[model samples]
Target: MRRYPSLVMLMLACSVAVTACKPAPQAMPVDPEPAAPATTAAAATPAPVPARNECPYPKFDAFLKHFGNEITLQEKATADPLLDSHIDAEAEPEPRKVESRLALADVEWPVMPDPAALAGQGRELQVNTLADGQRQVQIRTPDSSDQQTYTFAQAPCWTLVKREDESI
Candidate 1:
């Protein structure tokens, strides 16, 4: 075996030099996660309930009175996709009832007449409760052929679901 003292010393010197020139080890940077939005009293509040589920009036009569006058209340009291029926006098066969579903946007407002004001306007208004607890309101002119019937059902509160216009 041959001993290379100079070679060993040279290798040791090179290793020391390399170690001295090398940069110190550093910890990797970490990014923090975003925080959630704060929940205040207003933010934590529940969504508004539908008008059909709320009954501010004790009787149907009072509800109808307010429903006809207030446009906002009337819109809320009316059902979406309302069932609209009218006589189709121009049908191929004899005149027949044409039924169509009308969306909230398509529905004409103020279709209902206030019972209290009907008599004053020289129009007769009759409200009858059906066997199924639905209110049928019939509005008619004294001698004119104009007439309209509105049907309201109470699921949790009175809501106008259907309208039949027999007026020519």
Candidate 2:
């Protein structure tokens, strides 16, 4: 009877030990379904480009109006007969209206005059662009001579070349 009880206890302990030593079963792997393909068109559409406004040359009327009164006063004092004769001899026969139009085309604002010319004339020219897109040109002639300044409104981004010596 005593041997039977010990044998039963040993069997129960062996069964518990075996169950404790067993490894757990691994879980099965599950894969997700494949994603659908992206749709395609026959051709790729391009975005439209915005149109730019045509930039006109600077308004010469504004320039003339700004400096004309002052220039007229100076011209009376410094009128040179010989230089005037030479200028007239070389001048074109265009009417004042045509000349004004040509001058408009020649005076593209924001352009610096020839540095060499200014140096030769012993003068200094300074240009400044205003916040409102106008350009102000200040010219100081030789020996700090009477300063002449002009403001050209509605100017364009281009280089300007004087057509004649008188144009300067």
Candidate 3:
């Protein structure tokens, strides 16, 4: 997907103006590659999206018991076949397909942080329940230099959920 230079400039400017504390996520340049023939029935329809928009992770004491905040996400990035990058001339000039799949069994879950471990520490955690039922957690550790905030949601982009403004 080719982005317009002017539009990209505008977005960059807007992001710079809006976020001064944290780095804004920049859009990755999309390079469309050729697609291969689909032989399976699963390839006929598009991949299904999550049914709900709520946080998929457990929260509060339950979170501490099971998975304590530490999480990792794995994704498969793909684009249309509009470039020659996916083509192989020496081996089968005819493109069969270009795809990568991640098996559920292949995913390795990280060790979750124990809430009890942070009990005696001066770190303070503030969990806010939003109107949309998602939770945003703000962590202000003993070191006043840096603070971190994260949101949890059912969508793949759980961290980008809106939060209550604390500008006042």
Which is the leading candidate under TM-score? 1
TM-score of each: 0.65, 0.26, 0.31
In candidate 1, list every pair of residues with a backbone clash.
none
Which candidate leads in lDDT?
A: 1
Off-target runs (Cα >4 Å) in candidate 3 are 1-61, 69-113, 155-168
Candidate no. 1 TM-score: 0.65
lDDT of 3: 0.43
lDDT of 2 by residue, 21-75 (tens): 8765554334323222222222344555533223222344333333333433223
What is the lDDT for 122 in model 2? 78
The candidate with the higher TM-score, 2 or 3, is 3
CA-lDDT, candidates in order: 0.82, 0.41, 0.43
Residue-by-residue lDDT tens digits, candidate 1, 93-144? 6878889998989887776866778878999988999999999999999788
Model 3 lDDT tens row, 78-128: 111111112222456453423233243443333223345555666666778
Candidates 1 and 3 compared: the better one by TM-score is 1
**lDDT score, candidate 3, position 99:** 29
